[model samples]
Target: MPDKDAGTPRVFLIRHGETEWTKSGQYTGRSDIPLTENGEKQVISSARLVVGPGKIINPSKITQLFISPRKRALRTYELLFDEAARHKFEGKVEITEDIREWDYGLYEGILPSEAKAGRKERGLDKGRPWNIWIDGCEEGESPKDIAGRLDRVIAKIREIQGPYMHGEKPVDVVIVAHGQILRAFARRWLGFEIGVKLPMMLEPGAVGVLSYEHHNVDEPAFLLGVNMAESEE
Candidate 1:
């Protein structure tokens, strides 16, 4: 429904279901965190929402499935078909690291409280901003670095779109991935400023359908929908 006739692929970007770290608000990056029980339930419901009632995705229309090689994302993709309630997505699937989760350095497994406490304990919170993206404290990644990586991913997506976004066919692309990285990909692909204070909201087990329309000046990428999780219903 989101402009597949214009050679623009209707990309369905879904973040994997929740993990223990996700529930605890920890910075889950690169670490392999399995889906929680509720998270698996979310996948089943979310898949039904996407493939059935929502009617957002057409299986035949889907040309390819791109995924991050991470465990969580891989499991999410597997659940899409194996889950009893979500049999509609039995389509071809492929994995792509270009869509992998962002690699957070020293801050990878640290819980939010520990981070804040450590900051105060060191007496550095006064001068530096507390937020990770804005501050980029210590060995962690700065927004600038993330924005740059996102740009590379965006460039790859654009390349796949072909002929500078002038391809003439309807295509659907499904990307199974993690939260923060997928959000960054969507933001960068839409030409949003990198590392802005306001970030796109892409919850676990959430699906974001993006419509890319080629215009004379630039290809306008609009969000057909964002953060469509089972929790919403």
Candidate 2:
């Protein structure tokens, strides 16, 4: 039987598994890096234990799947769902640039320390500090730009949720993407402004849930560190 968590709708935010750059603390924006062997194994385990017939994400409950255009996110998505469950999924899986990692621009392929040092050398920091949310990247997106892009996506997700929240049908959505973007999405999901430091940290291969507090769409909230033990119906 197809499982359904009727009433409140949810948007599951998944961070892709580890990559070479991720392990080395390098900025990996728009880079097409594949996951490491351990990363693959971790996600495979996550799929088996966290997403299945009677798991945190019931295959029958998914209404839509959003993925970043990057290879890591795509691989994570593939690993998060088994072949049979993927075949059984009736939702639309869309690869959107909107959910891609924040373009690191001049900071790409470099560590934060290197970028900050470079900025200091160039007198860009003005003797203070460099915050991506405030100062942004040299050639990449500002916080406001990211907010604008994600807000549009959020609006579309809300459109999908309207019917589900109103008792029309069950709708659960999933997003597989990078760490920074997923955190930003969660903050924006609750209508909060993006800050220099995000309120939460999303570890590699971690999953977070965003939904209404008590079945009211107006009161969106984040279910921090959602584990399979607490989510199973």
Candidate 3:
């Protein structure tokens, strides 16, 4: 039987596993990088944590699984539910381009430090952010772009939530995408201003859950949690 939690379609947003480019601090906007071995382990662990019945999340409770077309995200999706057990993350894996990493444009595949130093030498980093982590995006993407895409992907998820929503919507939705999308998704959906200036990072295979009380476009949606990663030691 499917489990119902407080009568709402809880969404679990996760960042993909680590890649060679990610380890070097390069901007991986739209780049398809495969996960490291450690990344696979991390995905399995996080899956147990969130999708198990012992926690607030359950796999069967997850009606849909949306993934980024990138290799890292696709790998995470496969590792989490490779065999598809009844009690585990057994769901359809769908791909959404809107839920992709921030498009760095000309800056993709370059290290953050190198970009900053070069931009600084060229006086482009002045009044510009160093890392996308705390300072926000500079050469890659604007807040409007982030906000716009987040809005679209989230709206798409909300529409899918109508059928499997249990007593809430239609069904529960679980999205496996990138860090930038996860951060923006949580911020916009939860309506939190605490970390607006900071770009959020997720451990490869980390999970962030965003829940809401029905829908009220005027007021804040409500933030359930963020940056929950796997302890694959």
* Candidate number with greatest lDDT: 2
What order do you get sorting by TM-score, best first? 2, 1, 3
Worst 10 residues of 1 by lDDT: 224-233
Q: In candidate 2, residue 108 scores what lDDT?
A: 96
Candidate 3: give the clashing pairs: 133-199, 161-170, 162-170, 163-170, 164-170, 164-171, 165-169, 165-170, 165-171
Residue 54's lDDT within candidate 3 is: 41
lDDT score of model 2? 0.82
Estimated TM-score per prediction? 0.77, 0.91, 0.75
List model 2 lDDT by residue over 70-179, tens digit each: 99999999899877867766448888999999999999999999999999888887866888877779989888988998998898888888667745565788999999
**Tens-digit lDDT string for candidate 3 (60-130):** 45667777888888778777664654335444656777778887765688876776777677776466466
The TM-score, computed over Cα atoms with residue i paired to residue i, of candidate 3 is 0.75
lDDT by candidate, in order shown: 0.69, 0.82, 0.66
When summed lDDT is taken over every stretch of 10 residues in candidate 2, the lowest stretch is 224-233
Q: How would you order the candidates by lDDT, starting with the best?
A: 2, 1, 3
Candidate 3 at residue 178, lDDT? 80
Model 3: weakest 10-residue lDDT segment is: 224-233
Tens-digit lDDT string for candidate 1 (59-162): 54555678888888888877764454334445545566667776677668887778778878778779665876566646766667778866765565555555
